[model samples]
Target: MRSANPARHVSLPFPRAPRYGPEDQAAVRDLLHAGRLSDTSRGPAIAALEDAFADLTNTVYALSFASGTASLHGALRGVGAHPDAGVVTSPLTWISAILVAFHAGSFPVFADVEPGGVNLNPATIATAGQASAVLVTHTFGIPARMDALTAVTGVPIVEDCSHAHGARYASRPVGSWGAAGCFSLMERKPVSGGEGGVLTTNSRTVYERALTLGHHPHRLAAELTDPALRPLTSTGLGYKTRMPTVAAAIASVQLRRLADRMAASETNFARLLDVLHAHAAPITTPLVAAGSTRGWYGTPLIITEPVPNPAALFAACTAAGVPVRPLYEDWLSSPLLQDPALLHEAFPHVRHTGWRPPDPHALPNYQVARRQTLLLKVPDVPAADYMHQVGDTLATVLTQAIR
Candidate 1:
């Protein structure tokens, strides 16, 4: 008894259905029975999740944290990003990536994104100047080019894998390429811990340093073997950043289902792309780079030809129940990085270290890409029939919008 109208007939779940299976419920239930409600440090559940995640990402070590920001903070400090040091990254990313640098009391720097893409341009890294650390964000689940980046900067790299869970680059996982890879387990991320984070690394020193920065003594005692860090183990550097036992319990379950979810998500996005190619034009498909796989934090459709009315196109799509929208409507990020007066006035670190901002036109590629792109929120569940309706709705709306 569905309505013939595409808008009324369409039934796609935005924000996704609660992704927990019975296994997830069981994880929490078992933890409660064991009386481990929340551990001040990485508990048995947290440690187990960390080990499993490290294995999944092909890394030697994984450390858990209370949130994604904490994990990034730990990583920056772990790799020696101090007040005198500088951390450089592209401006076209979540503000947390830049905020972490300031959190560590380090000067933040920016490099332009690649031409017509979200990832950083390797050639421009030199122009950004010598930074003590490089932090990379895999924007919208598309892996940053690690090989190109590695060739340019000798400084350590920390990846913010907030969007990318199963996404790979050059046949290698995104987290495995850097000195430390930070993943957010916040409810919306591919790996939902409800609220938690993980930092994966290969270096023993980095692991212990990151562990000591946020974890309590109990964890540090067992995990820290380095002589330099042993003295701090009494209080473990005094920050309680352990993943909640409950979150760990949830994440462990989500980790097991990640591959399956990604595969199903891929199928759903592919079907929509098929519809777009055949029935929609001017509203073009995403230009995925060669060899780079999308984690699909978002599925962006770039407008190939200028539409008569951009607002009309977005409104029509929404009216048809497609829920298409724009991103970075104001693409300029880090106003402080541009205005030296504000930059120096805001942070003492900037004044102490003479780090100048890049030219306004430094990020021309990201500028164009951000404006042209329209984001589609894909269904997290495998609702195949519903996907077809959603795709058809967009196709019909787009065709009408151009007319």
Candidate 2:
């Protein structure tokens, strides 16, 4: 093996998102020129965005929100994650999952991720004990084992498909499988606005409840089908969580091009993997379950076998200008979640949650996975043949160690 190939190394860009094209620019311009932005009603762009999302997820209703967090909160609450009720969810996910539980005034039941997986283990959800709702995030754009999860819990499942815009499980779109699905259209997600979110559901009751939680009465009055909830149209839970019309316009343009973007990413990712293997680098692709298709947000490459020092690889990659970095801290072990004292200090009225900290040793897979992760920052709209350069960069970085 060669000592180095600095001359041949590719210059790959680090993670950055919220790409805009001519179409996105044009759409935003059109919306701005129209001068019809308002919270009084679901604006035309937002309504169109909702329709696009509903079509993508195959759901009956899709409600836009100011952000993913708000959408998730609405979804959990819509499906009965209220005070004293337990919401079963993975600890190895974004804090929003747990925060949504708090937002709903519910206890969050922390469940372990499956061994050798980044998603919640179905067995753990089954054993979590009487959860009123289950919230699932397709962590890092890889779809969780939805079939197993649905099989275990009778509770309404609210999917946090923030990381997974176009990802699928069992040949079905992720957000559609659950009772309600929540998505974030953040800068870095697979499909994004500058900042926005959407909640999708089939049930009329769930949709209405979610709409009421974040949206205003004006929309509620127009859209509310349930006669009983019509009275609340005057106020609609007193919270304003609608996505800005301009953001909706930008997101709608992105949504239209989502399929093509995904296809390009898939090609780039496959070629990049081949390039890695060609050099025999000690890194593996992400783990996706059977019948699953990932949107490939940022590829979480793992290091296993032949045991090249993980730290050395990270440093070499960094020094050689490879677009890779160490994985983030484990969400499950973070003091932010474990310290109930913090919760008490922050919210005096809220007490008593199903917040059981799992034994770290028991989640051996996640511990090892997090420790071994190399976050390869793939572009949202991939550059033509850019992945080949990324492969070359990583190969050069690992040349000394992989040998």
TM per candidate: 0.88, 0.90
Flag clash pairs in model 1. none
Expressed as tens digits, the lDDT of each residue in 141-179 for candidate 2 is 889888888998888998989988888987899899899
- Report the C-alpha displacement of residue 218, candidate 2, in angstroms: 0.6
Alpha carbon deviation, residue 243, candidate 2 (Å): 0.8
Question: Looking at model 2, which ten-residue stretch has the lowest summed lDDT?
Answer: 1-10
- Model 1: residues >4 Å from true position, as ranges? 1-16, 283-292, 307-316, 325-348, 355-361, 396-403
lDDT of 1 by residue, 1-403 (tens): 2224434325655536567878889999998899988786666898798998899789999999999989999999888887665798877777788868877778667888776567777888887866889999987787888998988889999998998887888888888898999999998788888999999999888889988887878777877899998998788877788888899889988888888778778888887767566554456654455766678677667777646676677776777677665564332334766677876677766677746665656667766766566777776678677777776677666656665
Q: What is the TM-score (0 to 1) of candidate 1?
A: 0.88
Deviation of model 1 at 235, angstroms: 2.8
